[model samples]
Target: MRSSVVQLAHARLLIVGGGAGGLGAASKFARKLPQNSVAIIEPSERHYYQPGFTFVGAGELRLADNQRNEEDLIPSKVKWYKNAAKRLVPENNSVILDNGDTLTYDYLVIACGIQPRFDLIKGAPEALQLEGSGVCSIYLPHLAEKTHREIQAFKSGNAIFTFPAGPIKCAGAPQKIMYLADEIFRKRGVRDAAKIDYYTSLPKIFGVEKYAQALDKVVKAKDITLHARTVLKEIRLNTKSAIFDVYNAEGKPSGETIESKFTLLHVAPVCRPIATVSECSSLVDAAGFVDVDPETLQSRKFTNVFAIGDTANTPNAKTAAAVSGQLGTLEVNLKAAMNGKPLGSKYDGYASCPLLVGGNKVILAEFTPKGPLETLPVNQAVPRSVSYLLKRYIMQPLYWHGLVKGYWNGPTTIRKILHFGRSN
Candidate 1:
C-alpha cells in the first residue's frame, strides 16, 4: 500500500470526468495550483466530441474527426485514476473508485455527463445488437460509423426518426437527422417512395417558441410528417416494423398503437446521468440530474461541487457550447472558494445547438435560461450553409483545443463585444 504521507497531497482537487467540463476544470486548476494539487478520475480510453455526431449522421462529417486519444487530453502533471467513480463521498471529502481505491480531495467537480438508455425502449437494445437491423443511432461514437451506410442505402418504405421523452444533449438533433433524410431521399429521386416521418414526445418541434414556430414551417414545407406526444414502444427489426404509442396532450389515452414498416429507423435514446450519480437521490433532481443553480452552476447542497454539461439539472438546453459557458463560471467560483472568498461567478445559462438539416445546411439555435426566444444577430431561425461550415469544421476543433485547454470561455467575450455590454 502507498504511504499516506505520499498518497494524496491535502490540496488535491479531484475531477470526476475526462470529458469537456472535467477536462476544462482540471486544466484551469492545474494552471492555478502545484503539480500534486490536482487529480482526475476517468475510465474512458478516448474522449469524444459529441456534438459532431449530428453532422456524422448527416454524412457531412466523419466520426474520426471527433475523437482524441485519452493520454493526449489529460494534463500531464495531474495524476489520473483510470477507473469510474462509483459514489461521491462528499462528507469525507473523498471519492471511491470502481477499483476500491480511495481518493481524498479538497475539491470535487462532477462532469460524468449523461448515459443513453436504449434499453428503456423495448427491443431497442437487442434489435440494434443485430449486425444490420435497418436501425442506427448517432449517440455513440463507434455506432456513428454505421449511420451513413444505413442512410445511404435507404431507398423506399418508411424512413422514421424518433425523439425520446426527456432532456438530451443538443435538443435539435432528433429532427436534424430527419430533415437530412428528407433531403437525401429527394436528391435520390425516391422522395415519393419514402414516407419520411418524425415522432417526438415533446409538444413542439423545437423548445423555444420562436425556433419551434420557425421549424414547424420548415417541416411542413419539407413535407416531413411531425407527430408530437408519440413515443416508440418497441423495435421489431426482424419483421421490418416498429411499435409506437400515440397520446393526446390532455392525458386522455389515445388507443392508437402505431405499426409502421420501415427501411430505416433512426433513434435518439432517452438519456440520464450515469446510474452511479443518480443513485444518490440528494445530489440529483427529479429527473436524476445533478441539481445545480441555473446561474452559478454550483450544487445547492455541496458548495465545493460544481456541475456542467448534460448531467447538470440546469434548464438550459444540453450542449457542449453550454459546457463552455459553465466551465468559466465554475473555474471562477472554485478559485474564489479555495481562497476563502465569496463566489461571485454566475453563468448566463447560454447554450447553442447546431441543427444539421442536410449535407451543407444548419439551423443555429442559441439561447439563454430566461427564455429560448433570444438568439444571435444572424438568421437564427433559418437553415443556412454558413452555420453548417462553422459547426462541422470549426466548432469541434474549438471544443477540443480551446475549450478543453481552458482558453475558450463560451462566446461571452465575443457576445459582450458584439452587444456593447448591453446583453447578458
Candidate 2:
C-alpha cells in the first residue's frame, strides 16, 4: 500500500538538507514567508561544523566541539522534517521522502551536501574500521577522533596522506591535516624517524597560485615529499601498505604502481553528490552536480530551483565561507523568481580557506576567479597567528550565531572596508 501523501500547499519555501547552506536559506526565507511557510528536510540529529573536523583530527579540538544538536541550529518558525530526501521531482516542484510522503514547494533550495565514497577505494572501508590498523580519515565526523588516535599511536615509518582526484568539500583540508600530523610527529619525537608524504592527483598543491607558492616553501622547509598527479588505487591492511597509480600529462593512468608502507595512512575519500540530487538527471550537470548559474545560483532548467554549497557545480571552492558568500545571491535570485523579477544580486565566486600550517599559524587563502582576494590589507599568503585565531575563535562563533542565523553574508563588506574600498 502507498503511504499517505502530506501536501503542504502553504509551504512557500522548501530547503533540502539542514547543513549550513540550507539552514542559512531557511533562516532568511522564514523572515519573508509565514511561520509555517518554510520547511527543511534533514535526517541527522547532530549537525557538524565540518571545518572543525580538521582540528579534531589534529587533536587540537575535541570531536564534541564541532557538533550541535540539529534542533538548536534550525529556526523554530520553519517546519522541520526529520526525514531524508529520496528523490527530487522538479517537474512537479516536489520532493519524495524516505517515509514515502511527498512535499511540494513553490520555491526549492537544494543544499544536499556531498557524500563521501569510501567504498570506491578498495579495502578502505575495512581498513577504516580496524582499530590501530594504521588507516584513518578526517573527512567523516566519526573518523576525526580515530584519526587523532592514529596520529597519537604513530611511533615511526611513513606518515602518508592521500588526496582524492575529484572535488572535495575543503580543498585545503587534506594538506591541513598533513601539516598537523607533521607537528604531532615532531612533538612525539618521531619526526626524524618518519617520512611525511602527500600524494595528490592534482598537478599543483593548491588551485590558487599565490597560496600554492607559499605552500611550496613550507613543503621544502618541512622536508615533506609531494607526489603530484598520483591516485590511490588500493590499501593492503595486512602489510600496512598503500598502492598508487601515477597519471601522465594527459591525465591517463601510466599503469605504474608505487607501493608505500605506512605507520599512519590518512585518506581524503572521493566525494559524490547525494542520491536525491544526483538521481534527478534533469537537475544535475555532467559531473552529477546541481547545474546552476555560478553567479546567481539559479537553476538553468527550473527558475524556481536554486542550489548552494557542495551540491552546486560552482567553480568556487566548496566551503562554508563560499556558502556564506552565495547565500545573498541565492536569496535575491530565489525571491526574485517568486516575485517575477530579474536577479539583481551576483556572487563574485568568493571563497576563503584558512590553511593551517602548524606552529599556531595559518595562511588565509581568500580568492576568486580574478585572483587573490584578501580580506586584510596585508599579504595573506604568508602564515600568521592572527589568521589561526580568526579561524579558531572568530569563525566558529560567527558560523553558529551569525551565518546559520542568516545575519552574516560573508566577509565581503568587511574586506571592502579593511582594504579601503579596493577589494573585489
Candidate 3:
C-alpha cells in the first residue's frame, strides 16, 4: 500500500475528545461560534454512559440501553473527525492525527478521559474474559455483563472485591458493585455461604469524612469485611488466588502480603490519562495528568489550552458529576481567554457520588474541596430511597437531554434553591 499523504487542517476551536465532557462543550460552543468553526477528533463510533456500568453489573440496567452512536450526540454545526489524536504539538497549537492529517486550532480543549490498565494485575485481562473464570469488572461493557453473570452464578466461598491504588474514573464503583452483589447473594439465599471482603488502597471507605462515616456504618450493618490500605497486586488464575500488597499507617509498603482464594473477584482497575496526552511530557504533570490551573482549568504552559474530565489535574473526584460542575467554569474561562478578558471564574472542586449501599438505598455524597456541599435540606449522609430513585431513574434522562445538550451545569442552582439561597 502507498503511504498516505499528510494534509493540514485549521479550526477556530478544537476539542480532542468525544466523551461526555468534550461532547457537552461542543454542543454549547458550536452554537456560539461560526458554523463548522469547531472540530472534534474522536475515533470511537459508539459512546457509553459509563456511570451506568455499575447498575449494569447489578443487572439493574442493560449496557446497550446506555450507549448511543457518537455521531448522534455530536452537534450539527461542529465538524467531527472520526480519528484519534496521534501527537500534540502545543507550541504550534496543532495536533497530528492518526490518519496522517494535522489540525491546528486557535483554542484547544483536551478532554480525553482515562483508560483502564487491566494488564497491571497479572492474569486479570484474560481472566475477565474466560468462561466461568469467576473474575469480572464493571469498567468495560462486555466485562460488566460478565460481572452480572459471575455474581449470579456465585455459590459459596470467598467473594472478593478490590479498589486500585491510584485514582480511577469512579472511586465509589468498586464498593458499589460489592454492595449490590451482597444484596443479590442475600436474595439468592447464598449470603451465609459467601464470605464477602473488600480490599481498598485508600485509608478509609470514602474520601469525604461525612460520607466515610456513613459508609462505615453501612459496612458494619451489612457485616461486610473491609480491608483498608491493601492493593490487589496480582491474580493467580490457575489457583484462583489473589496477591495483595499491604500498606501500613506510614503510607508505604509494609513488606506484608495477603493471598486469598476467591469464588468471585470483581476488580476496579487502575486508571490514568490516555496515551496521547500522557506521552506528551510538556503538556502533563508528574502524575500523568494535563498540567492545568486547578481553579481556572487553563493550561499553565499554554494559555490557549484547557482540560476537563479525568485528564485534568484538578483535585476532585473524577466523575461525570464533577465534569458537570466544571463545564460552566471551563466555558467562562475559555471565553475570557479568547476575548482577552480577565479570567475570573473558578471551579470549587465540587463532586457528587451517589453511594448505593443496597439495591434500593443510596447516600448522596456531595462536597467541595473545603467540605460537604449538600444540595438538599435533609442530611445527605443518611442513606435514602429517594436518592436511589434519583440515581436509578432521573439521572440518565437528565444526562442525555440536559448535560449532553449543554443545558445542565450541575446542581449549583438546585442547591441554592433547596437551601433557600444559603448553600453553594
Candidate 4:
C-alpha cells in the first residue's frame, strides 16, 4: 500500500480519458481557451486508433501503425495531468485523481471510454492466457496480434465468433472479423474443412434495418451460421468448448444452454462503463453511463458537465465516427453554458461503421437512431470496393490529422455537398 498527502488543483475546463473523444474535444477547447485553462487526466502512455483493430486482426495493418504516443497527441496549450480519475464529484465540480489529488473544474467532460470485462465470462481470462488455447479477442491491444496468430493456425474445425449482450463500442466488430476470416479461409483453400459460426445476443444480424437486411444476404451467400439472441456464457478450455444461453425474440432467456466445440474462438467480450464513470452514481444512468441529453450532449443534472464518445448514454452507436459527430454539438453546448446562453446546437445521433465484409469490399453503414444517414449519394447498404478503399486508405489519416486534431466534424458537409445541398 502507498500513502500520500491529498492536494487540490483547479482548471477552467477538465477532460478525462485520452482516447478519441477526449483528444478530439480537448484539441478544440485547448485552442479556444487560454493557455493552461484546459486540463486532461489520462494515465496511458500510448493512444490507439481502436477502429483499426479489426484490420489488425485481419493482418491488414500492424497494431503499431494504429498507435501514437499519448504525449504527442495532447494539445500544447492544454495542461496535461499524468493521472487517472478515480471518482467524479459532479455536484461539487471536482474529480479525485488516482494520485490522491482533487481537481476542481468550472466545466467537465467525461470521455472515459468503456471497459471490456473478460472476467464476466467464466474461464475466459484463463483461456486467453493459455498458449495455443485457440481463444482470442481483438478488443485489447495485446490480444489483437494473438487473434491473427489464431486465425493463421486454424486449419479446420469450428471457427466461432461472438457478440455479447448490451451495448459495445463497435457493434459490428464481432462479425467484421468473422467476414475477414471467412475470406482468409477461402484463400488458404480450407473453406470446405472449416465451419464458421457467429453467436450474437441481438435479435437480428445488425441493429439498423437496412444494414441488417444486407448482412443477412451476405451471411446466406457465405453459408455462415448466425445464432441470434444467443450469448456466450462460459468457456471450457480443457474441452475446447463454449456454453451459450439462448434467448427468444422477446429478449428473455429460453432456459436453453447449448455447448459447442471450436478450433478457434474470437470473443468480443462484454463491455461496460469504466470504473470512474460507473462508480460515480450521480454522473451515470441506470446502465452505468454518463446520462446526458441525446441532442444537446449536456448532463441531465449538471449543466456544466457533458459527455461524448462511448461513455455517453446516447442512442447512437458507440464508434469513433460518432465521437466526431458529437464533437461539434458538445463544443457548442459547452460554450453556450459557459457564456450563459441557451444551447441551440443539437446532435443528430450520427454514427458510421465501415463494415469490412470481405475481399476488398466494405459496407459503409452510416446512420442515426432513425435510419441510415449515408454521406455518399450512393446506397451505402451495398458493399463496394470504394467503401473498402475509404476504410483502408482514408479513415486512418482522417482520424489522426482531422478528427483528433479537431478539424473533422464528421461527413455532414460532404453528405450535403454530395446531395447537391438537398439534405441537412
Candidate 5:
C-alpha cells in the first residue's frame, strides 16, 4: 500500500484518458489556452492506434507500427499527469487520482475509453492464458499477436469468430477478422478443411442498411456461416468448445445451448465504461456512459463538463472516425461555455467504419443519423480495392499527423465539396 497527502492541483481544463479523443482535445485547447492550463490524466506509457489491431491480427501489419510513446504524441504545452483517475467528483469539479492527488478543473472532458471485460464470460480469462488453447482475440494488443499465431498454426477444424451482445467500438471488427481469416485459409490451401463461422448477437451484419446489404452478398460469396442472436456463454478450454445461449424472437434466452468445437476462436468481448466513468452515478446514464446531450456533447447536469468518443452516451458507432467527427463539436461547445456564449455547433452523430471484407477489398461505411454520409460521390455501398488502399495508406498517416495535431475533423469538408454542398 502507498500513503500520501491528497495534494490538490488546479487546471483551466482537465481531460481524462489520453487516447485518440483526449489527445485531439488537448491539441485543440493547447493552441488556445495558456501553458499548463490544460492537464491530461493518462497512466499508460504507449498510445495505440486501436483501429490497426485487426490488420495486425490478419498479419498485414506489425503490432509495433501502431504504437507510439505517449509523451511524444501529447502536445508540449499541456501538462501530462502520469496517473489514472480513480473517481470523478462532478459536484466539487474534482477528480481523484490513484496516487492520492485531487485535481480540480474549471471544465472537464471525460474521454476515458471503454474497458473490455473478458472476465464477464465464465472461463474466459483463464482460457485466454492457456498455452495452445486456440482462444484468441484482436480486441487486445497482446491477443492480436496471438491471433495471428493461431491463424498461421491452424491446419484444420472450425475457425470461429464472435461478437458480444452490447454496444462495441468498431462494430464492423467482428466480421472483418472473419473475412481476413477466410482469405488466409484460402491462400494456405486449407479452405476446404477448415470451416469458418461468424457468430454475432446482432440480427443484422451492420447497422446501416446500405452497407449491411452489401455485406450480405460478401458473406454468401465467401460461404461463411452466419449465426445471429447467439451470445457466447462460456468457453471450455480443455475441450476446445464454445457454448452459446440462443435468443428467441422476443429477445429472451431460449434456454438452449449451442456448442461448437474450434481450432481457433476469436472473441470480441463485451465492453463497458471505465471505472471512473461507470462509478460516477450522477455523471453517467444507466448504461454507465456519460450522460450528455448527443448533438452538443455537453453534460446534461454539469454545464462545464462534456464527453467524447466511446465514453459519451451517443447512439453512434464507437470508432476512431466517430472521435474525429466529435472533435469539432466538443471543441466549439467547451470554448463557448468558457466565453459565456450559447453553443451554436451541433454534431450529427457522424461515424465511419472501413469494413475490411478481405485483404484487397473494403466497404467504406460512412453515415450520420439520417443515412449514409459518404465522402465520395460514387456508390460507396459496394466493396472496392481503392477503399482498402485508403484504409492502409491514408487513414493511418492522417490519424498520427493530422488528427493528433488537431487539424483533421473527419472528412466533412471533403464530403460537402464532393456532394456539391449537400449536407447529407
Candidate 6:
C-alpha cells in the first residue's frame, strides 16, 4: 500500500473496529508492541460490553452498566482514526475510510464486528421505530433499557422471544431475555397470567450440548413453549400480531403463517459482517464472516491479517469472553509472524455464554474447540449464585483491569491450575 516493499518490518498495525474485540486487540497489541505501532479504525464514540445488555434488558442489571466512553477504552499509545472503514483493499494492504482518507498498513487486524439486520424479517424493517411498539429486541443496546420497561408493564398473553434463522452475536441472547421475562413475571405474580414462548429457528436452546441440556430442563420446568425450527416471516403492528413460517421435522416448507398475538416481542435480529469487510469475499466464509483458523486466529488467506470476535468465521460463538481468549492467541501469533517465525500462539476457540437464569443464578458455559471446556471445577451447567455474583460485580472490574488492559485471557488456565494444583 505504501510502496512496493514486501514488508514494513517497521509497519504500523491497523485495526478496523472499536468494539470489545477490536479495542481489546488494540489494547493488547498497543501495550505490547513498540511506540506508535497500532491504529484502530473505529467510528463509535461509546464502547459497550454487549453481553451485559442481555441482563440489562431482563431488568437484572441497570441499563447504564453496559457502557464505557470509547476514548477511555482506547489505549493512549495508539492512533485512533474514529472513522468507519468504508472499504478494505486487502491485496494492497490498505483501507479507505468513509471520510475519504486512505490508511496503509504492513499488517492488519480485521476486528470489524457483525451487524444485526432486522430487515431480513419481512415487515420488520421499521422495527426500531416502534420503540414503544410490541416489537423489541435486546440486540440493540439503545433499546435494552426500553425492553426492561416494556416487559415490566406486561400484563398477560404471549410473551414471545424469537431467534433469527442465522448467525447472531451472543447466540444465547434471545433466550436469555426469555429467561429474564420468566423471572420477572414470577416476581410480579404475573407468571401464571403470561405464557412465555421461545420461538427460535435454531434446533436447540444453546449450541453447546452441556448447556443446551441444562437450558432444556429450565424451559420444561418453567413450562415455557420451546418451538424449534420455527421462523418469523413478518409482523403486523396495527393488528398486534406476528406471522411465523413454521417448518416441519424435515427442515422443509411444511409451513403456513401462524399469527400469534403478543403483549411483547423480543428478537435477536439476523446479522452479517460490516459491508466494508463483506466485499472481500476472499477473506470471508459462506455466511459472510472473515475466515480464520479456529486455533491460530490467523486469516486463512493472508498471514498478515487476523480477526477476532464476531467478525471472524471461527466456530466459537461470538462473545467478549471469546475475544479475550483470542487476544492472547493473536498477540502471540502476531508477534511471531512479525519476526518471520512460526506461529507461537494457539487459540483453543474458547468461548463462554454466561446465561443469567434469574436474578441470583447463572449458568456459566465455557468451552473450547475440542469440546465442553468448563471453567468451574464443579458443574457449570447448573445455575449458581456464585457465577451470578461474578458476572454482575467481579467480571466488570476484571474486564476493565485485566482483559481490556491485556493481562487476562479466558479462565481456562486458572481453572486448570487450581483444579490440579493440590494433586500435581
- List the candidates' TM-scores in order: 0.93, 0.97, 0.97, 0.97, 0.97, 0.93
How accurate locally, in lDDT, is each candidate? 0.80, 0.90, 0.91, 0.90, 0.90, 0.81
Residue range 157-216, candidate 2, lDDT tens digits: 899999888878898999999999999988988899999999989898888999999999
Higher-lDDT candidate of 4 and 5: 4
Model 5 lDDT per residue over 182-264, tens place: 99999999999998888888787777889989999999999988898898989998788999999877766889989999899
TM-score of predicted structure 1: 0.93
Which residue window of length 10 is worst by lDDT in model 2? Answer: 1-10
Give lDDT: candidate 2, residue 244.
92
Q: lDDT of candidate 5 vs native? A: 0.90
Residue-wise C-alpha lDDT for candidate 1, range 141-235, written one tens digit per residue? 76676777788888788888898877777777778778877887888898899888888877887778777888888888888899888888889
Candidate 4 worst ten-residue window by lDDT: 1-10
Candidate 3 deviant stretches above 4 angstroms: 1-8
What does candidate 3's lDDT look like per residue over 86-107, in tens digits?
Answer: 9999999999999778899999
Q: Which residue pairs show backbone clashes in model 3?
A: none
What's the CA error at residue 378 for candidate 5, in Å?
1.0
Q: Supply the TM-score for candidate 2.
A: 0.97
RMSD of each: 2.9, 2.7, 2.7, 2.7, 2.6, 4.1
lDDT of 6 by residue, 1-424 (tens): 1111122223379988887777778888887788778888778887777778877887767767778888887888777786788988888888887877788898898888898888888777675566677677888887888788889888888899898776788887788788888888898999899988888776787778888899999999899999887888888888888888877776655657678888888867888988887888888887788889888888999999998888988887787788888888988898888889999887877888788887678998888755677766789899999998888888877777787777778776787786885311
- When summed lDDT is taken over every stretch of 10 residues in candidate 5, the lowest stretch is 1-10
Displacement of residue 165 (Cα, Å) in model 3 is: 0.8
The better candidate by lDDT, 1 or 5, is: 5
